[model samples]
Each structure stands twice: as structure tokens, then as C-alpha cells.
Target: MVDFGEILTTVGDFGFFQKLIILALAFQNVLFPIFFCSFLFIQSDPERHCNTDWILQADSNLTTDEQLNLTLPREEDGTFSRCQMFVPVEWDIGAIREYGLNETTGCRDGWVYYDTLYDATIVTDFDLVCDRSNLAEVVKTIFMAGLLAGSFIFGPTAESYGRRRTTQLPVVLLLIFITVAGVSPNVYVYMVSQFIVGAALGGYRINSTVLEWIGVTKRSLASCMSQMFSSVGQCVMAGLVYAIRDWRRVQYVLAGWQAFIFLWTPESARWLLGQGRTEEANKLIRRVAAINKKKIPENLLDVTGEQEVQTHSGNLVAHLSKYMSFICVLVILRFSLNLGYFCLILNVGKLGLNIFLVQFLFGITEAPAHFLCVWVLELIGRKKSLISSLLAGSFFCLLTLAFPQGEFHVIRAVVITALVTTGKLFLNWGGSVCMVYIQELFPTSVRQTAVGFGSIAYRGAGLLSPLLNILAVYHWSIPIIVYSSLTLTSGALSFLLPETRRKELPDSTHESNTCNNCI
Candidate 1:
């Protein structure tokens, strides 16, 4: 009979070839976040402002429906319908100018050619202020809600099928959904497509598994590198958004890039070996050896032996029993962090600053933060790093709340901007640590389910962020205060988690040294 336990143990201890495969898998992690951040551009309401001038110049004698049909582009089906676009005459140029249109060069002069009934008067009377409560905002929220659902779904599936399959599958699906989302005939299609894309992209979790597969000496460096890719993704997303302002074109570009990832990426050898597919695993390992120009050990084939075959088993209930308590704390922290993060990013215009500048600065700041996290996580340990970040982020979130209502525009801008951006560093770092920790906690049998359940908490919070933003308008400081409190509490809960630095991962309940009641 095959000694399944022995094979699993050998495979669990990764070699140079396996490590390289894990690193390659990490690239998918980078791409997933880039696709995720691009969502901000897709959900943008700026297009509404672009058409403001045209809507105001429509014939005054025309009915509202007639005016809408005259101003908006014909639908893909060749129909003039209000349902085709989310923004209507309510966002016309006259309204935008009234609220304070900054630059007024695009829709001037010859662009306005109309008869007497549809006079081409320069509309300076309409309000420039965008309504926060609108279809655009609602669609954005729904898209994020899909991200929440996707995260949970992907985490478990990745664990069950193997990291490479779970990690790369989403990239393919994201490409398709993003393309569909971009070319969507109307806002309704756009909203649905964005949600599906969010779900597809949310399946990536290779960073955590990659960290676990490498040597302890390499863990911090590897973790840092993984985070750096996310920052790179952010910068890339910004550049892509700028290059392709048309939302659909942006989708097509991202989709095209994602499709390329499958060409170079490989499966996780550890996962394959765990399933007792040594020959297949060896083939993959040899491919890595070939690429890196290293010789594969002939003994590696014998290493699989006659052990390590075991049926993986886990469900939602089993997942909860393992880490429900810890997961709960993370959920609360994620919800608050996401609420604050999205609230600030989504409403950057409300802060009276250049939106593009704010986003660019935010992306630029992440480079240093990623490096800092690498340094801090190794020195203080994962629990301390997580707690300290949460506390710092909470403090800054609180400061933003205390600043006077209408004083020191520049100072408030600098202070609030610093607080939120710095807070993002902590959130991102802590989140990375959480991903690593969750994967380490469970055995391969239930790892996917555990990861999936934990992801639910993270995504669930994301779903609620848009609604929270709406509330922030009426009570600006409420979200800040709430998020700050949640961070502090999650930090305190960190004390309950066992520190797992430099420990060999446990293979079964017998070898497991889990902290009792730690969850």
C-alpha cells in the first residue's frame, strides 16, 4: 500500500524548481490587483460631466424625452432610449457650470450648431455639482459587491484545485468579463459585467501560498516582492487609464494582457505532488529547471515515493470551526478599512483637489510602504506588524475626523491625504500578512475552504463600501471614527494569534501546535 503521508511530507518541502514555479505564480497576484484597481476608472462619473454642455443646448421646446434622445448617442441597437445611458439631462453643461466647471474648452463654438428652438447658448447657469445619489454610484457599489463574493469563491477553489489553476483561471475570466463590460450596450450591462469581472479577478491568492512554499530566509523578501508588484500594478493601472480614457477600450486592453499570462505561468508543483501525481509534477519541475538552467536531480523522481495520497475534504462548516473567530476580527478590520479607503478614493473630488494628482500620489507612495512592510514584518513579526499598522492607521483616521470643518485648505488636504494614504500602507501590509497566516493555519485538505471563508469577510466589507460612502456625505466623520475603532479592536485581537515565525508547517493534527482558542 502507498504510504500517502510520506509523499505529502516530501512534496510539502519545496525545492529550487518548485520555488521558481511559486514565484511565477506570484506574477498573477500582481496582475489581479492591477485589474482590480482599474475598476476605479470604470466606475468614474467624469463622463457625465463631459456631456454637460451638449445636454444644456438641446431645444427648450423639446420634451425631456425628446431632449434626451437628441443629445445622447444612439444605442448599439440603433434606438434612441433613456435607458441606454445612466447620466441624463440632469447632468447637462448648464448644471455643471452652475456648480463650477473648471475648464470649458472642449464643447465650445462650432460644436454647438442648432436651430432657433434649440439655441446654442453658452450655458453658465446649470449646476456643475454632481449628485452623489445616482445610478453611477449604485453601479459602482454593485461591482464591489461582486468583488466580495468573488474573493470568497476564489480562495476556496484555489486551495482545492491547486494554486496555479485557481490563480490563472481568474485572469482568463477577468479578461473576458472586462472586455464584455467595456463594450456593454448600456449602463445595466456595464454594471452586470463589472460585477462578474470583479468576481473573476478576485480568485487570486498566490502571494500567501508562495510565501509559505519558500524558505524562512526568503519569506520576508518574497513577501515584500509580492507587495511591490501590487504597487507596480497600481502604477500600471494609472498609466493604462490615462492612455485609454474610453472605459471599454481600457477593458479590452486589460483583457488582452491577462490572456498572455497563461503562456508563461506554470502549475504549483507542491499541489500536484500532494495529489500523488509525481510524474506530472516532475515534468513541471523539469520545465522550471530548463528555464532557470539548473539540473534536475534524478533522485527527485524517487522522492515522491509511496506516500502523501489523501483525499482533500472541507466545507463551509469545517472552515468556520477552524478559524471563525480570527476570521471575524479580520472581517471587521477589512470592512472598516475598505469603507474608509473607498470613501476617500471615490469622493476625492469632494476634497477640492485634482483627482488625477491624488490617485497618482497614492500609487507613488505605495513603493516606500511596500519596502517598509518588508522591513517591519521581519523585525517585529507578523502579529506586531499587523497590530502596529492598524493602530497607526486608526490614529490617522481619527485625526482626519478632528480637523476643523473649513479651515486650512492646503493643510487639511495634506494632512487628510497623508493620513488616508499612509493608512493604505498599513492596510495593505496587514492584509498581506493575513493572507499568509490563513493559508498556514489549515492543512491542504481544508486550506481552500478556510481561505475562501476568510476571503468572504474581506469581500463582504468591500460590498458595503459604496453604501457607506453615501452615508459619509451626510455624516462625514462617522466612517472615519468607526473604521478607527475597528482597527484598534482588531489590533488588540492580534494578541490572541500565535506567532508562526520560522516554524515548519504542520502536516496533521498530531504535529500541529496551534494556539488553543487563538481563533
Candidate 2:
């Protein structure tokens, strides 16, 4: 009996048909980050200060700055305090200014915003600053929590229901959840919607059987191309933020964009074969064969020894028991890379550049990073590529500490952002290639399941990234140090992973166990 892998090789696995599937699925990859990182723009807290209208009313002659000085308390460095005001007094504003009153308290008449870039955001509209500022991060964490839950749900389904249905399920759910988030009546509703959106994204990206559609040899190329679209999505999201000042409109635009993906995506023929639906699998395979202008021998169509196909699902527990250690390394790598990557992304505003430009730069960098990742993976192989990328990312993180953060604020921001961007770029560059590396590390029977295990770490780090932003406020260099340490440690551990540079993919547990470091 011909195994499905042999049939795929016969059908021209990386041909026109696979390319169409890759292109359709790339949209999903793009949408994932838009939802994941939407908080950067949508929940941004702009500059604010206590309302001084009472002082203004008491002295009509006072200028805005003068009113601010008399009513708004000043910090040690002399900037107007953001959350406190002078206690109400019987003295006129002129008397208050002349006497220099010292008593201060929180604003009783709400607050005022000035010089804010966004017309509306969750922070400003919901007043999630000061004591409530942490809620912004809480909502962000809620999304990651959903993703952790999804990693479990989608993995088995991707194996059983097949990749096409698994991919479509999340896209449909994303559309629904994001729409609810856009129209949410309050922060409570929005946070709940964000959680569901996270779960959908986790299901899609983590359990991605997208790479399984093409030949094992072509997996790197397809992943590179799709991730380029992921980068493209990042740039597109920045443009969306720039054009649509209102956060709701941005969410709506992204939700509307997924409609095309819901309509056109194709199922994985390999998955169909695994489910023992050879007839249905061949129907799709024939379309691929036609697309590639290839022909199959009539006898090759008959699939027998179909016992393995029928029992693949039941075989997972047996497969994983032997491959647990290798999967653990991958899970750790996922956590480390994402923790550093997202730490920088979630704090883009603090980088001291035009928020749109900084975000656009972050997105644009990933395109080249994906391409570069593929090239490096081909040249040096997976093990060295990850080590080199991680080590360099660590070095750059330390390099940021040496940057002159004195007085020239714009110059300082630009320099540090450049360094941080390079650091994150390499982490992601290695990460893109690592997907193929990890997938190749396992037998075909349990590849999606292995990916699910890694996504747990990936999403867990995502959950931690927003809370990690708190470290930045205590000291800018602290997050850089923490991220660098994690990447460095993971890089050291990566040296122990077996390289899969140019080998045929193992098709079963017996083959994989004897491969990698086993021999």
C-alpha cells in the first residue's frame, strides 16, 4: 500500500494548488497579530491632567498655563501632575497663585484631556488611568488567557476535523467576537469579547495545519511567504490606526477583511487521507494534480493497508509519550521568543517616536525577517540559526542599556527603538524558522499536537507580556534586561536540540524515535 506521503510526492506537493492554499491562509496569519496587538493603539492612554475649570472660572484673566500652575500640582521635575489638583479654597485664583497653596487632592470634577493624539481610546474614554490603569493590561491578559484555552481546543480538531474546517472555525468566530468588541457598550463587554478573540487566534495560529498542506521540503518556503503576509498585516493595521482615529472603526475594518478568507480556503488533502477518506482526499488531490499539470498512475489511486489511517487518532497518546522531551524544548523556545517580542511591541508608545511610524516600522521589519529566516535556515540549518539569532538579540538588548538616554529625548528614543527593533527582529526571524524545525522534529502523526504544546508556552508568555510592561515604568532598562536574560537562557538550551537541516520528514513514531538524537 502506498503511504499518503508517497502520494503527495507523486502529486507535486509544492505546485500551483498548494500556493493557492498558502495565499488564502496567509490572510489568517495577518489577522492574528492585528487582533493580538490591537491594544497598542486601541487602548492607548494619552496625556491627561486634573480639570482646572474651577480655577479658570474664578479668574477669567488667567491664561491656560497660569490656571494650570495655580490649580494643578507639580511633580518634582515641574511637569503638571496628571491626577491631582489644588484643594478648593475660598481664595480667588489670583490669591491662590500668589499664596502658592500646597494642599492637593484627586480631581472631584472628573478630568480634562489636552494634546491627546487619539479622538477616543479605551483608556481615555473609559478612564482607565491612575488606579484603573492596570485594567488595560488586565484586558490584554484576558485575550492571552483565551488563547491558552484555544491551544487545547483546536489541536485535536485540526487532526480530526481536518485543517480547512479548523481554520474556518476560528475565522468565523473572530469575525463575531471582534464585531462584539467593536460595538461593546462598556469596558466589561469589550474585555469579554477580547478574550474570545484571543481564543480564536490561538486556535488558528497554534494549531495551524497550514504547513501540512504542502510538501515537507516546501514547508519552509510556504511559512516564510505566509509570515511575510503576517508582517504585511502589521503594516496594514498601522495604516488602519492612522486612518481610523476611532478604535471601533479599526476593529470593524479588520473584521470585514476576514470575509474573503472565510469564503475561499481549501482543506488539507493529507489530513483527509489520514482520516481514511481516501476517495475524498483523491478528489482534492486530483484538483492539485490538474493545477500542477501532472498525472497519477491509475493503480496509485488504490489505498490499502488502511489500518494506520483508521487508527491514527488513537495512536497519539503512544506517539507523545516517547517525544515529550523534544516537545518541551520547543515549548520553552516559544515562550522565550514571544515574551521578548511582545514586550517590545506592547510598549511601542514608550519608544518616543510617532506611534504610527514606530508600529509601522515594527511590522515592516518582520517581512524581511521572515525572508532572512528562510535563507539562514537553508544556509546554516535550524540549530545554528536559532542560536545565532537569539544570541544577537540578547546582545542588542544589552546594547540598549549603553544608549545615551540624556536630554535629547527624540534622539534617545530613536536609538533605543532601533536597538530594540533589531533585537525583536532577530528573535522573530529565528521563531519563524523554528516552526518548521519543531514540526520537522516530530512524526507527521503528532505534528499538530506537538504544536499545541508549544502554543501553551507561546500564549502563556503573551499573557505575561502586558504585565511585564509594568517593569518598564519602574525602569526602562529593566524589561530589556529581563527579556534578554530569557532569550539568552533559551539560546543556550537550544544548542542541545537536534538539527533537521536536510532530512526526509519522519512519518511515524518508530521513525522519529530512531532519528534526531536517538541514534
Candidate 3:
């Protein structure tokens, strides 16, 4: 039987039809950041101080600044304490300045945020400051836990149900949860809503699975182009937040825009074909050809499209049982790469740039990293590329040690931004190479399973990386040192996998010298 890939070539691999789908699906990638890092904009801990309502009521004649100095306690650096206040007293209101007190207590009445960039946030609304601030991280961790569960659950569900059904269910749930989150009355409600949205992420592929219709040669190009769109979405996210300053409004506006942006997106034709629903797949294919102003020869599709698409239900389990050594290497390497990746991602707020601009620049750097990996893979092949990228990223991270984090703001921002961004660049390439190398290392039947297995370890790193970054409180360089060490070790582990450069895709494990060499 002529495979779907052969049929896709005849219909035009990277034609206008695919472009329309890419355009529609790209918005989904853009919309993801609005939820994923919505915490950054919605829960940001702006400069805050204890609310001095008692003092303000005592005297309206005094200016705001004067009342702040008289009522609030100061730290050693003379900055007003965010979590503490001078004990409320019945001192003579006029001569209160003369009765200066050294003893302080926790913010009894609650805290107030400056609300510079955001009009309101969880920090200001719930008074998640000082002692209560750990709850904010709790909420974020809960959301991540939900994401981890969703990633595991959705892969199997997508195989059982049609891709369209999987997508439709999640998109609807995500919209509802996002709206609920926007209008949530309390932190618990908001976090639960965020968890639901995170769960819906498993169903959203951003059209990566759809590109499987294209042949291998064109599939790589299509994948790269699709990923670039994801980067474009992230690059523009900060501007989106800045323009829509209120977090709730940002959620509402993005939800409404997503409703329209995805209107043109249809179901995946490849998925339909995989389900052995040829009639439906053919209908979609004809519509695609019409949109692209091209024609599929009647005889060509008639001959090939009539075949039933059989799926191997045991493929994943079979691979898992057989490939212990390969799975081990992938899991460890993936965990290390992800640990470094998220360490940088979660700690960006401490990195000294405007959070909005930092997020945008973070997105801007991603697209080129893919191109760089492709270039390096050509130059050095997959194993060496992975090794060099990881080691080199470690070097950049170590360079961050030179700058004293807090004292040299202007200099640290300039120098560390360059170093961290470069480090992320190399780690990102290492990640890309891992994916490419895994596919090459495994036979077709088990490739997806291997990736899924690796992802479990990777997800663990995502959850753990943020907590590891808590070390920043003790010393800013500690997280960087940890990330550097992991990268170095993961790169060393890359030596275990066989080189696949200039080699054809092996059809079976017997033709695979990779596992044998490692053994």
C-alpha cells in the first residue's frame, strides 16, 4: 500500500493548504503564554509596604510620604518594611514623630502594593506578601502539577479518540477555566481554574502532529517553521501584557481573540486517515486542494487512499519492555536538559530586566536556536552537537558567577542577560538535538513511546527546578552552578549513544548498532 507520506507529496507538501492550518494553529501557541506565565503578570510582587490605615485616620493634614515614615518601620537599608509595622499605639497624634519606636511587628492590617505595571494582582488583592508569599509559589506549583498530569493523560486519549475531538474538548474547557480564573473571587478559585486550564494543554498540539502528513525531507522544514511561530507568539507576549495592563482583562481579551483566531482551523487530515476513516480524510483533502488552488489526481488518491490504516496498540508497551538501556539514557539526559531549561525560565524575574521585555527577548532568542542546532548538527552530527551544546552552555552559565547579582544592576543586567540568554540558546539546541537523536535511535514503532517515556523525567525537572532556584535567596550563583553541573554531566552521557550522521533510518533494532554499542 502507498503510504500517507507518498500521497502527501502528490498533494503538495508545503503548499498553501498547510500554510492556512499553520496560521490558524499558531495563535494557540501565542495564547499559551497568556496562561502559562500569566502568573508573572497577575501574581507579581511589586514594591509593597504595610497598609497604615490607622495612622492615616489619625491625621489627614500629614502628606502620604510623611505618614509612611512616621507609621511604618524601616529595614537596615532604610527601605520601608513590607511585612512589618510599628505597633499601633495611642500616642499623641501630633508628636508621633517624637515617639519613635524601634520594636516592630508583622503587618497586622495587611500590605499594600505599589501596582506600578499591573493595575491589580493576586499579590495586592490577597495580600500575599512576606510571610504569606509562599502561597503564590504553591499556586504555581499546583498549576505545574496539573500540567504534568495532562501531558501524560492526553497522549493516550488522543490515540483513542480522534484528534479533533481531543482538541475541541480541551479548547472549550480551557476557555471556561480561563474565564473562571479571570473572574475568580479568591486565590483558591483562581488556582483551581488555572489547574483546569493546564490540564487542557495536553490536547493542544499547535499542529505538530498535523505535519506528519509531509514527507520526512519536508517534515523537518515544516516543524521548524511551526516552532518559529510559537517563538513569535512568545516574543509578542510582553507587549500584549503591557497593552492590557489589567490581568483579568488580558485573560478575557485573549479568550475572545482565540475564539476568532482558531475559527479557520479544521481537524487533522492525517489523524482522520489513521482512524481508517478514508471518506472523511478524502473530503478534508479535497477541500484543502481547493483552498490551495491545486488538484489531486483522481487515480492517485483512489488507489492509495482506499487502504485501511492499522495502528499497533501494543507499540508503546512493547518498546518500553524491550529498550531499558536506551530509555535510561534518554530519561537522564532529558531530565538534565529540562532542569537547566526551566531553571533559567522560572528565575527570569530575578535576572534584572523588565519582566515583560525579558519574556519577549526570551521568545525572540528561541527561533534562532533551532536554526543553530540544525546548522551545528550538519557540521558535527547529532552526538557531538549535543555534547558541544551542553558543555558550551555550561561555560556561559559559569560566566554569570563574575557579576555580583544585586550591586551591579546596570552592568549585571547587560552582562548576565547576555550570558544567560546564550546559555539558554545552547541548552535549547541540546534539547532539539535530543529529540532528533531519539527518533533516529529508535525504530518507527517505538519512537513516540521513547519520547513519552523521556517526558516523564523531563516533567519532574520542571516541577523541581523552581524549588531548586529557591537557593537564590542564599546566593544568586547557586542555581547557575547547579545548572552548569547538570549540563556538563548530561553532555558526558551523550557519548554513550552511537553517531547517526550521514546514515539512513534503520528499519529494525537488529540493524540498530546504537543499543549494541552502548551495551
lDDT of candidate model 1 versus the reference: 0.58
Candidate 2 has which clashing residue pairs, if any? none
lDDT of 2 by residue, 1-519 (tens): 676567777888788877777777675777766775456885455678987787656778888887787788789998999888888787776677678878889877767776877777777767777777778888888988999888888876676676778777888898898899988888899999998888888888865535665675677887777668888888887887788777877788878886656446677665666667767877887777888888988877775326446545456787787788787878888899889887887877777788789889988988888887777777888888889988998888789889845565877888888998888788787677667877788766787788888778888888898888787677767877887898999899897788787666665565676664642
Q: Tens-digit lDDT track for model 3 on 1-519?
A: 555555666676668877766566555766765676567665456788887778766676878888788878778998988778888877767667776766788888877777466877666777777887887777767776666666576645555564456656777787788889888888899889888887776446411334444445443344445456666677777788778777778778867865665645576565565556678888887787777677787765674434435442245565456667777887898888878887887776768777787788878988887766556676677788889888988889888898875564677697888888888878777776776666556644444445556656666677788788888889877888887898889888888888766454333444464554664
What 10-residue stretch in candidate 2 is worst by lDDT?
304-313
Model 3: how far residue 430 lies from native, Å: 2.9
The per-model lDDT (C-alpha) reads 0.58, 0.77, 0.69
TM-score of each: 0.74, 0.87, 0.81
The C-alpha stretches of model 2 lying farther than 4 A from their native spots are 36-38, 42-45, 49-110, 304-307, 310-313, 404-408, 516-519
Ranking by TM-score: 2, 3, 1
lDDT of 1 by residue, 1-519 (tens): 322233323444345544555566556555654554434543332223223334545334556555444444454786532222323334554554355323223322112122211111111112111332266566667777777778767776765577666766666677778788656665667678878877775566432345434555446656666667766666676666665555456667777777776334466555665566778877765665565455644665664523434432224465356556666665565555555566655655455455456666666787778788767777777778777777777776677776755754887887777777777666666776776566555555555666676667666666776676677667777766766787778778777777766555443333442643565
Query: What number of clashing residue pairs does each candidate have, in the order they appear?
Result: 20, 0, 0
* Alpha-carbon RMSD of each model: 9.3, 3.8, 4.3
